[model samples]
Target: MPRKGMRSLCFSSPKTLAYAISRFPSPSRSTAASLTPRPSFNESMIQQTIAAAENMIVKWNPDTSSFAKVTSLFYEDRNEAMEFIKCVNGLQKAMHLMVTENSGSDNLVRSQNLMQIAMKRLQKEFYQILSTNRAHLDPESVSARSSRASTRSSTSDYEDDGTDDDIHAAGDCISEVEHVSVTAMENLRLIAEAMISSGYGKECIKIYTIIRKSIIDEGIYKLGVEKMSLHQINKMDWEVQEIKIKNWLDAVKIAVKTLFNGERILCDHVFAASESMRESCFAEISKDGANLLFGFPELIAKSKKSPEKMFRSLDMYTAISENWPEIEFIFSFESTSAVRSQALASLIKLTESVRTMLTDFETLVQKDSSKSPVAGGGIHHLTYYVMNYLTCLADYSNILADIITDSTPPSKLHLPESYFETTDSDDTPAPALTIHLAWLLLVLLCKLDGKAKHYKDVSLSYLFLANNLQHVISKVRTSNLQYILGDEWITKNEATVRQFAANYERLGWSHVYSSLPENPTAVIPPGKAKDLFKKFNSIFEETYRKQSGWVVPDSKLRDEIKISIERKLVPIYREFYDTHRVTLGAERNLGLVVRYAPEDVGNYLSDLFYGTGSSESTSLSSSTSSSNRRQSRSR
Candidate 1:
């Protein structure tokens, strides 16, 4: 009897109905009942029509039998079909004792048992039809039927369930494959936790079984969703979603294994998860969970072989930022330790990928010097390289400490070390860039000018306080000896060192400026105020001259520099505040900012002085540029 307005359209013959019916209600999908055919065909007709029908059961009512054939004929031959059936049956039997539900939740074992019983009866019915019609069915049709059944068996969880397709299509709604995947993982997670909380120790096993069952039913893997599985495997739009969901699920499983001790036992549960990521059509997503299975080295190796693969990786990495809400949890403290660790680890892998991508992009850009020029003249990949590095670094930094993030320690060559270098070539002329960087770093640790001290002074001071600071400077400074020892480099430098001493003495007197105090006291560590003054006086006396002698010898020039600092620069900077600093009496203490040398200390206030934070300034800046353009036009 068919429904009033419709007939059940079977995927194939009614013989396969048992297999389809048996595999309903996948682990991830609770909506299995909706996939059943309406006014379905007779089971015997389907079995008789299919080519390889001997092993494919076409009929049987479950109320009559306890055993049913579960073999599917998708692969080929009756034996192969029987093997598939035997394997699933054995797996189901093995899974019987695997998991238990929490006290408040429904008993998973009972539910599983009931599911298996339904599966048994349905399979038996299918077995009867296939066996009876073996004489009429063709090998090709049997194979096709078997494949469809097998695909629906365990892998169908990710594939289209007939019910969802029509309903989803009617609504013009897209299936949130990724969301559903994450939800499935989360559900598994909750169930596992509840099982654990309920003192059921086999929770991991139970969750594993549930996941396995669901995956097998879908035929798409929990760990790996191959590209082969996705070529119009479902609706085109749904394919990508399926992959993403697979990725998230894969991520969850990794978290579970690493977070728990089951690290060694994969059970291939997350294999589909891995495939989901590695097999993604999008490069980034495909590469997303790759590091979990293949080391970054392999990716690096593969990327080298295939530029196309690498390009895909680059786009994927760039797109991840678009989903900040999902990733934001990456930074939270509440995330499971495993999830947080994986997030951080993923960043390191990403960094490596970016580095590799840039390396290749560099080559591509260079091979065409006759073409468009980019910045750095060389292959710097300036914009994207820095962007990739910074984004990856941010994720890495939150998980790791900031100390490692600071590139400025003795750890580098007092020599400016390249981020990476393959060879030390003597032919390469020594770049002065290293010395300047060294100087910049040195200034950060010390009070460069007595009048100016760096902000975060304590942290700043610590950079130098440790002996490594002096050691690094000394090591790097020694490298400059060839220049320093040269007649032109230092023949007069000795005299300059003496002059610096004299200059410091004259400058330190403070008596020269009647308005200024004779003694300038620095605020120091509370208990060591006296020692601080002593140290300061010595620094002005000895270090000011011999320490790192950079100033040119002109007393009047020093005074002029001081005058400029007080009169024009600082005053102009303060006036831009739009009266915001007016009521604050502490503006007097604005001198604290002056505590830092112009360079080392300017970082904190750089934006203050130059940032287009104010609307007025932005408009003025725009006008200035426009005015300059007009003048140029007139000229």
Candidate 2:
């Protein structure tokens, strides 16, 4: 079937084909005699002419002469060019037959070269024409010029001297070019869609790639436009260019989506499991608990590549906005919005999968923490990765905020004004995007909070919470995120950390007091003293061995926790010492029996979080004194 605007060149009819063949001028007898050595070249010349005609399907406006050029052996005659509407169609059919019948002949090779030559010529001409007449295609330029013309006419008392005829001519040129370009774009779109439908995705990719490069070239021209001032350029012109860039980006986005869609760009080996597979995993792990130890490695390995794919999906759209300001202008709710939405949706799905994987991994860590400190290390690594993901989310959300706020009628991004209360009189109220991001951060923190509870050891659990919470708080405070979350939110999280610290101290020191004798009235019984010493040694050894390996990460919080534990256990040890020192005097070694002095007990507690406790012990005492002074002053 003939393509649109090509019915006149009806190559399907025998009479039309004969007419097309007749249009090809025969070689003169004199010319043929001169080519005696190349006597069989007449058929080759006809094939080449057909190929050239086929390639001229898309004509270039810039290449045509102002005066009519004479037809040559291959060039279209001016009258025939108008007469043959489907010139490319007829020529393509003729070339196809000639190549098919004489597939390996030198004539076919010459035809191919002719076809290629026509392609390059037309492509170059198309690019030049689009570049030269760009302003004509831009609605903004037309609008701005018309506005200026109107203003001039009004000032001249509506007198007409045809001075603005050039502007009118430019408008006419723009209208004509706009029609041609629109038709060209539609044809390309159809071809691209057809390629995709036929599973020629790579071909489609190449097509869009060329389109993007061409549009970028046009953008370079647009960018070079000189303005009297930064804001002096016509808004309509900018808006027009923005639409053009967005249209191209939108097409590229679709092409990319086609490449990614329905193909498992993700390593679905981790998340998308059949019920049988899941059951088998559970059964295998249950049969030999050791299998559970290496199970997370597979999950982790599978997930490791997923974030990168997800990032690329997001970067596909974001990179366009970064490179092209015109496309960026229409990002949020305009032509590029669908592609952005698709990219964001893919990102969200990937992140949610990551969250689920981490959640399950945390469960494994909790169950394994008692058996191996390796589990704790793994959790820390996972926590760091999760933090990196959250950082990406925060940065991308800021970009979304900028886009959503600037969208037509404004997108505000579902962030309510009531969400954030202004903490300082001078501080500006947080933008909707910031508040939206703060909420996302909160959701992640809450997820981490749930994961922290998986640790069997109370101190390890508290340490996990402290490290992650402190990280979140520090990030918010250091970045622009503080304005959204506010000082109160930070204070609240700090208080939660203090609560965890208190819990850590309470659990860790619980056994210390129980080791003291109930009655050291006169001389404590030898058996009771022996039991007391043994219990004290047992608890002290256990606490130090376990907690010394755990980490708080934050120096200040670690010190505070150490000091709190010191205050609880120190006085108890001193009282117990003063009460039972004489009773335990019969022991040959008092140092071994009492185990620790009051100061030594304080030192041990100071050393509980991390091994560098001696310096911290001194700091603890100073802090205690300072705190006491502050309390006294308040009183």
Candidate 3:
């Protein structure tokens, strides 16, 4: 079934693939070498809080049914505990009930409200918890300012002298560490809230300072991860897959409340960190030190089960936004435009890189093929990236079209460098195909009803690009195929690309246009013209209709192409034939102009290529049949 330019694909979800860790079982690698543990300023306060939370865990374990399973999580059976206490408050689950329980008995309801409030407070102060400690959730926090003190409250805890400030100041004297485990952070939150709800808000400063100076600076975060044995790693692998069995929404809601709590101090820190990482990445790209992508051998790795167990707090939420950008703010209830916009900006960058890759693949292929020591990377990489790029854009197409319509930028979609600037010419300034320019074109395309439709827009772009590519492909001489697909030439460090044209007879392009007779006087050689004809045949035969998948073009499309050539090229060629007479013979070759031809022609030669003038044109016209006969014989 001959067809052109269509491929029907049936894709499967990437999730079906299984993932495994590269680490060995019971591997005896030392943590000190792999982890550069740092201390937090609040280390002492946090440790104190954790110790207190551990005590609370011991006390609460027997009675706390809601968190009972969590507490026993690190153990194979029912009785063990990991070192850190986690926040299994299931915080978001409480949001609706907090607002709805307003009509109940003030004391009875308030106590419940306080517990709920305490959890909210707990998550805020503590941050994220380590999975190992998820079962024994530390109290996330205490109520903002409780009216009634806990019956078990300490007298010194509620002291109004602000004396804890001195202890907090003392935290400055301790050595610092790097990275805090979400688990350790959660322990601090529970302790701080417990103390405050017990009437010790003034003591909060000492707690924060203790954590900052000792734990944050010292890096308890790195240590917690480093502490994980091969067994723990293996356990984590199970937990990720098992999350689907639990109420995932419950976990997500809790996370949203904590991360989006609108803390001025913490928000700023997050912003600073994200911006710094972005800047560093950009600078590295500009400097051309991106070794992982280009020079190094590529790895085919899939995400592991329970991937979230290993993600940082910020990444977990942001990834949700990436997958569901349209409903992100709605689901998380984060009304801040800056936050939403930041998410969108991140999505935009991701989309742009994806766009760059999809567009520049041909160039990459050509370059890779040119290398002397070829890297035999398979089509799997290309297929994977293309499908990923398309899937992401397709999912977000509605959001993108909406944004494009509203933005003042001339184009709706922004493209990377490789799209318009096909040539990095020395004679002129690099052609302006900047990202902003591509956006202008996208904006225009978005306004078009056809392009605004799903899959239509992408297909429209593909066809348009393909058409222009055909023009460029047509202009390339068979001789210049070497220069055209540069990388492939370099890979062999040889002129193998020329073979795309050179193997015409063997490849059958030569046979397709074998009707043309020799005309050495023409600007292009008879051989070259025949090859060009072959290339035209190839665009349909070898390149398009020959794909390994489904395709069928409309009959009218083929007919229209024939009609177009009749209208455009046939008349043009007719005029050339009438005026040029395009006559030549071997007798004119042999010595002066042509190569060592007629000398070899003496060997029972049929004929040789030569040009003809006015009288020669008469002879050429009269000899057209004989000339055609000679060309057929040469064939």
The Cα local distance difference test for each model comes to: 0.30, 0.43, 0.28
- Which digits, one per residue and each the tens of the lDDT, describe model 2 over residues 1-635? 11221123332344443343233321222323322333233565665656555445324222353232222211334234322223333343344444334434444344334333333333333333334444442333323333333212111111223423533444464555443433333223223222222223233343333433343334433433211222322323544434433443444443223211101111011112122322232222121211211121222222333333333323433544443333222232232344344444433443444444433433433343233233331235445655565456555654455443432222234344543344556476556655544555544555555666677877667667777777777666675566555687789778877877676666766776666655434466776776776687777766665665566767777788777766666666677667777777878866666666666566556555543322222232212343353454356
Give me the runs in candidate 1 sitting further than 4 Å from their true place.
1-224, 227-301, 305-388, 398-635
Give the per-residue lDDT digits (tens) of candidate 1, residues 1-635. 11111012132233333333243222332233324333433434322322122222222223433333333232124334333333333322222222111212122233333334333433332333333333222222222323332211122132232433532343343234422322222222322322222222132343344433332222323445333232333333444543543464443333223211121112211222222221121122212232242232222223332233443343333333233233433222232334334444544555465445534443443242232321111111332232243233334222223222323222233222332232454465333333322233323322122112221223212211222222222333344432322333333333433443344334432322222222333222332433332333343223212212122223433344345334433332333222222233244443231232223212222222111233222221112243353454356
Give, for candidate 1, the lowest lDDT window spanning 10 residues: 1-10
Which candidate has the top score in TM-score? Answer: 2
lDDT winner, 1 or 3:
1
Cα miss at 65, model 3 (Å)?
30
Mind sharing the TM-score for model 2? Answer: 0.39
The clash number for model 2 is 2
- Write one digit per residue (lDDT tens) for candidate 3, span 408-483: 3332233434333433444643212222223322322222212212222232223222222222222222223323
**RMSD, candidate 2, Å:** 22.0
Off by over 4 Å in 2: 1-306, 309-379, 402-439, 517-534, 578-587, 611-635
